[model samples]
Target: MTPETGKTSIPIPERTRPPRAARRGAIAIRFRPGPAAIAAAALVCLLIGLLYLALQIRTIFSDQLKQEYAGLVLEAVERAESARNQVGIWQQLPDATEARAAGYRHARTELAHRLASLAALVNASPSAAPRLSPASFTADADLRDTDAVLGTVSAWWRAQRDADSADVRLRIAHVARTLIASAALLFCMLITALGMYAKRNRLLAGQSHEFEWAALHDAMTGLPNRRKLFATLEAAATKLSARSASCKIAVLYIDLDGFKQVNDSLGHRVGDEFLIAVSKRFRESVRKVDVVARIGGDEFAVLVREFSTNAELGEIARRLIACVVQTDLTMGVGMVSASIGIASFPDSVDDYHRLVAAADEAMYRVKRNGKNSYAFADRAN
Candidate 1:
């Protein structure tokens, strides 16, 4: 094919080094190369888990601070009532009314201040619970005994405050325990994210590599085409020349006989199967070192390397003829066959044109001699 077809010529990128901006964009895009559905689900789950943990902690601390503030308020009310009782007891004594009244006034003022503080604490509990502490308590005879009915009944108020304080402490401990559990879960989620990222990156890399290979390779048959064949031969010839190896490379030109007849007689549908069968046999006939290509309609070529004598080329050509003849076309034909032509490198020519021309000339000789035969060209003749 000529360069005008735009198949053989590859365009070089404007910048050998990709632009910095492009590199950054590619990294950003590649970073999220994970499956969209799976990534979205994982992200949603992570957010929900974190929110659940936060709400649990909030509920625990909120209840704790509320109970603590309520206890403080109850304690202040109990102290106020206790002071009023003392005032009444002092009033019963002669000449102590004024002194007891002043003490009662002071106690009332302190109690008012404590009540204000408790109001502020409860009001701020929603926001400040994370930092608030439980209330401090004092013990007395009335608070210690419940059997003293009058004594216990008077102290029942303080008992309520103590119970509230206990509730507050219990909630705080529950919050702390839950926070520890949440931290462990967060660590596990982070580990899972890391492993998933690595696995996704590897998968994307492999897919990218496979995509590149598929771009240049034929889908029907694994063999290269004429364009790839030419490129490979050029590279191989350079390497072989440098080594100065006593090697002769030969090209086997193959044309499938009665291929068109099979297509015409048994529909193109069955013909496709026949072609696939032919491609398989071609692959089996060549050695690992050989490069094979489907150059045209019903025509294939094989580049055999490191042959020391004409006898080796003749033997290979004979094997190829036998391989095609032995293959069952399944189209109810007598026998399938291919005429092969052998052309050697260096001895044939120094340039690509001369080498290909020699091979083509040999192929025509096979056709002229009779079908299902082989021929080799001699440059000296």
Candidate 2:
């Protein structure tokens, strides 16, 4: 199939392949991808959890404080009414001046005690303690009105006591309502902050995962590139290096024999198609344990970690060659062939670089000696 790159061509297997450079270049470009992108989603999730917890704490405090404030205000109003009634009866008796004065003294003391208790309750809330003040209750306009009404009744000791008592109760109720309103506002603000933080965290995490996937994959061929290949190889080598089993690493360098003619004859479009076809063939022919990579122009390498004999190696090479040679091309070119070079580790060379070099040398030998042959660098004893 024709690809978007317009660099290679797909032809029937019968046609000779195009230039190796075009095929390799196209494959490399197809698979290369950008670096890993940072995921902010995880961070976002963490922040959301924290913010939610904080909001919950705030809400609990607001609810508790509001309830407590309402109770205290009601208790204060009841105490004021009781004290006013006791003093009023003494004043009406006229002969009980000393008793009335003593009750008034006791009544003022009770009011002070109740106010202190309310202040203590407000301070007990961990979240609200820093924000609340004794002055908030005492300075409240409704509370002030209640205090004024109580003072007037105590000073006059007349028929105005019932009217003043009603005013004090209404004022206390108003103060409690104001406290609840303030608490509701605080709750809304906390929840809003939590929502904003959660949204930010999700965005960050999604980006991070997106970038990670991009890093491990090839952008074009959707295959693992050299970077991923080397990582796996390094890990495998470390595992095998510790063992002395008859384990062997086989490195194969494959080059398309007559690929240049395809590019020269049909055009670059057909050449790219031929390269994609070659990649597909390699995938189909290689064993499950083998990894193939397109390192550069028309050149592919395979790392095979298992194989007991040269015959086994030859079988794999023949399969690869056959896979490519047998492909049908529609570009009207003749049959194409591949030259494969094989090298083994611990048998031909000790180092990875030398091993690859040996395989490369063997591949050139195949090209020089004959186009469609597999060559080996290892000497037979």
What number of clashing residue pairs does each candidate have, in the order they appear?
0, 40
Runs in model 1 lying further than 4 Å from the true structure: 1-38, 41-224, 231-235, 238-244, 265-274, 328-336, 352-358, 368-371, 377-381
Model 2 RMSD in Å is 18.0
Q: What is the lDDT of residue 311 in candidate 1?
A: 88
TM-score for predicted model 2 compared with the true structure: 0.50
Q: Write the per-residue lDDT of candidate 1 for residues 1-381, one digit (tens) a residue.
A: 665755577888775788899999999987754445445655666677667667766765665655565565455446545554553455465665777767655654553444344334434544322221222111122322212322332354346546656766775676676667656666666666677778889888999988766665565666677777777777777777887758667788888777787778767776666666767877887788788787766777888867888888888888777666666434456545788777888777556545656777788888888878888876645
lDDT of 2 by residue, 30-119 (tens): 864322111243344445555655665565555555545545544554566565455445546656577777865665555555545544
Misplaced by over 4 Å in model 2 are: 1-219, 328-332, 379-381
- Report the error of model 2 at residue 284, Å: 2.2
lDDT of each: 0.65, 0.64
| TM of each candidate vs. truth | 0.55, 0.50
Best by TM-score: 1
